[model samples]
Target: MKLKKRIFTILALIAVAIGVGSVCNTPNTAQAKGVPTVFPKNMRGTWYQYYTDGVEKDLSKVKITKTTYILGEYTPKVIHKYIPHDKPDFERADWIFIPGYQKQRGITWLNVKQWNEPAGIGIPDTGDDGEDGGWGENGGEFFNVSKLKGHQVLSIANTIDGTSIHNTSHWYRSVKLAKKLNKRHYKGFLY
Candidate 1:
């Protein structure tokens, strides 16, 4: 009798442990195979550019499709005209788009330029500063880029302050695409 009772107790404990482990290991349904589903489809549109010091520039178009974002030039002039006088002039190059991940913002992007490569580009979401709570610093402001309608402000992150710090360098909004341009413009940046 004693042997049978001991075996029963051990079996019960093992079953309980397996149950708890399975519950803990369950995957989050909100994310698909680890990729988030919150990205907006209509993120394609023209957005105004602004600098960290509150300097605003001409409107630039942003074309976002299923997998990428193609950014247009802020001005028509050559790269040298726009860069600071002290900066070196590189060859005139066409725009290149690459996929990027912002763990802090929780939104992946097809980027024309590397995040923070240009002084005033990148998305900045809203929330407190730090990792102790609430998406830490970048977790809370996961804006639905696809849902951004025309004329609404899109806030950009300020890289100079620090990745842990959330600062606003630019605010942009969706505007009507020019008649000459088509939805194919969202495919990639044209020279």
Candidate 2:
């Protein structure tokens, strides 16, 4: 009788284990339902330029123009003029853009004329006069170019200590604008 009781207990435990396994293997119902997808569009065009100088400059004094251009599969060359008030306002450069591929990163290039412009007033205060000299002593600001879309580019940059930095310009789509700038000889491919 004890052996028969043991056999019944083993069968009961095995049945419970099988039932639990089936329940665990069931698929989630939520994932089986459908869902929608959305993709983002690119932003490219001629945009006004703005400079920030902390609290010293008024936000209203910023100047802008609609003369920028977007270069596709070619080099963008341009002559830029800068106005100096509290700081320099413009820079000339070449820009290039390459699209991204599957599992691969995109490509971009920028050749800035005066890549490092100086900052600081001519005075070094009372303590650090020896260590302070105007221009090229502390290095210049940093700039970067990124693809916003097929016909657009975004420039991200910052100053020496990484403050008052912002997006500076947007190039409008113009195939003719690329030719007038005159390429200064560059040999490279963006793949």
Candidate 3:
């Protein structure tokens, strides 16, 4: 009698698990690969550019609400300057990465689509120098931000290059150490 009851309980648990999976209507092995429309809390900050020489430049006074891109939404007419050729189809972007990107290159992938709930449910302070926690912009007039490094910002945009044929990228960071690092390099030259 005891053995029969244990077998029935185990089977019942398995059935419930399968039932829940079906109700969710998502494959058990499903993984989200798209970025969320909302900007993550970690990317907020006034990032100062870190040049190839590792020098921190003047802080950007530009006020921008952090956000992500939904490539299919905007048309060429809207974001014409940002696009390279202004082609009709802009749904897919082309870039190739080596297989096993994280394992081989140690690249951290920020993978998600939409917040589990909407933004502002539970918030934390990132101290982005008055760029307080809020929803990102609907339509941006200028540049588009690509990658971030916690307190730092990394961007590869046509707007930054400005009429140059070649595209360029840069890295910026919010180093809270001092106003300007390497002060000894130049007495009156720094900051």
Candidate 4:
């Protein structure tokens, strides 16, 4: 009986050691405190972006030039489950990540009508009341990421308005910018 008890104790210790080893080998995705794993200081600045050819359609009516806001230090992990307007019930979580950036994990619908896709109407640089437009083929929209020293500008030319429309999606970082937009921001997922 004593021998059996001793064997049991030895087995328990081995199990515990194995369990600890497995846990130690597990990878942690969360950022460590005080460690700048993402969004290094150099990344915070104003930037100007253009198409691959450094040219884009003229969108004067949309007026996206004056838009400035802060982007989150960490890239959000986004999970997209597209709900088609004209198809059977189907859902899928699209895992998206920016190469050499942070993870984005949220599903958001891009309203097409409010999008400045056409070439006549105008949209405010920041607000909730722009013409809605549909999402792109991948249910995503593209924005030019320009940096400007504590402020970032995302410019998208409104094909419909013949102007650049600023999407104030980052106004929540401060108070002054929020007041300018009447406390309303664009509805695009950051994380």
Candidate 5:
């Protein structure tokens, strides 16, 4: 009995050691703590995006500035799941994100949208009528235009390739190759 007890203890110790020995370190994603007042300098220019771009669709014609990320007249919905509109109602929408950046588990690619793209900002409606009329999509309809996947999160890499801002996404890519590229490392995309 004493021998069996000793063997069990030894096995438990070995299991614990092995469990603590292997740790998977993946490269990543991050969101902002507070609302960023303005855009950064690194991503402050017009970039002709390819299919490999992040969430926003300036339709290859993406313009970035200190305060806004302006999209072109034609933005398709396939690349960005939360666009919410069949067709752009106006020429350009200078949107901003109020919910901050997002990248949860069970999925790859860090993306943000209004009141959740499956999930996003949970800002409850004060009393403005939109699609769901609450913290749902179009939460910014008659309220604020910047809280959706307008891709302000997408334009982020262009803003600070380093750490110019706090809220950020790792989905940014190179439009030149029309292939795919990442300026920021993605640690959140765990497959």
Candidate 6:
């Protein structure tokens, strides 16, 4: 009787341990604390306009399409070669372009810093101007994704010439052909 009771107790303990382990090992889909995955899936894609020699080729509307990660993050060497005056330690964000109004441009990493701030306001910058206090288009526009329901729109702040030209318009449309790109894979900018 003592031997049987001991065996039964051990089995019960083993079963409880197995059950607890399984529950603990379950995959968690909840957003991790520090991981930045809040960006919507519908917004990841390539937006472009037909341009020839830096000139608009036609008045046709702009188009956006999802593509495999192609564009690479600016390496230290590339950044130094092109934008030497700017700080090398910069994070990349999604590129927001408003055709005709604001040609193809990146949302600068500065927006990330602002967004991280406790009191940061508006959508982060999708364009980089390179150096600080320099005359270039570095400031990004603020976009409220929560307000945008099924409407693809980019609100761009006109950082050029210090003008307050805030242009917000609906994109022609969005096409998703390739896998959806996110910052998790690319680190800074979405491919």
Q: For candidate 1, list the clashing residue pairs, or say none.
A: 40-146
Give candidate 5 misplaced runs (Cα > 4 Å).
1-33, 52-59, 73-97, 103-175, 179-191
Question: Which residue pairs come into collision in candidate 3?
Answer: none
In model 6, where do residues sit more than 4 Å from their true spots? Answer: 31-41, 44-64, 68-145, 148-151, 155-191
Instruction: Estimate every model's Cα lDDT from 0 to 1.
Output: 0.36, 0.32, 0.31, 0.32, 0.37, 0.32
Best by TM-score: 1
Q: What is the C-alpha RMSD of each candidate to the true structure, in Å?
A: 13.2, 18.6, 16.0, 14.8, 15.7, 13.9
How would you encode candidate 6's per-residue C-alpha lDDT over 1-191 as one tens digit per residue? Answer: 99999999999999999999999987677423332222234544443222233443322232213321222233211111121223322342222222112223443311111221112223334568542321234343332222233444333232333343334322223323111211011111222
Residue 74, candidate 4: C-alpha displacement in angstroms = 29
The 10 consecutive residues of candidate 2 with the worst lDDT sum are: 95-104
Root-mean-square deviation of candidate 4: 14.8
Q: In candidate 2, residue 30 scores what lDDT?
A: 49
lDDT, residue 149, candidate 2? 34
Residue-wise C-alpha lDDT for candidate 3, range 1-191, written one tens digit per residue: 99999999999999999999897986354245332333345544444432334454543322223443323233212111122222323243221111111111122323221121113222333686553232222111122234432324433222111122112233344444223431212111112
- The weakest ten consecutive residues by lDDT in model 5 span 138-147
Q: How far is candidate 5 from the true structure (C-alpha RMSD, Å)?
A: 15.7
Pitting candidate 2 against candidate 6, the one with the higher lDDT is 2
TM-score of candidate 2 to 2 decimals: 0.21
lDDT of 4 by residue, 1-191 (tens): 99999999999999999999999987677433322222333323443322122344311111221212222333222322222233222121122211122122232112122222123222324546573342222222333334433454333322223222333233212334323433233344332
- Superposed by TM-score, candidate 1 places the C-alpha of residue 150 at a distance from the truth, in angstroms, of 10
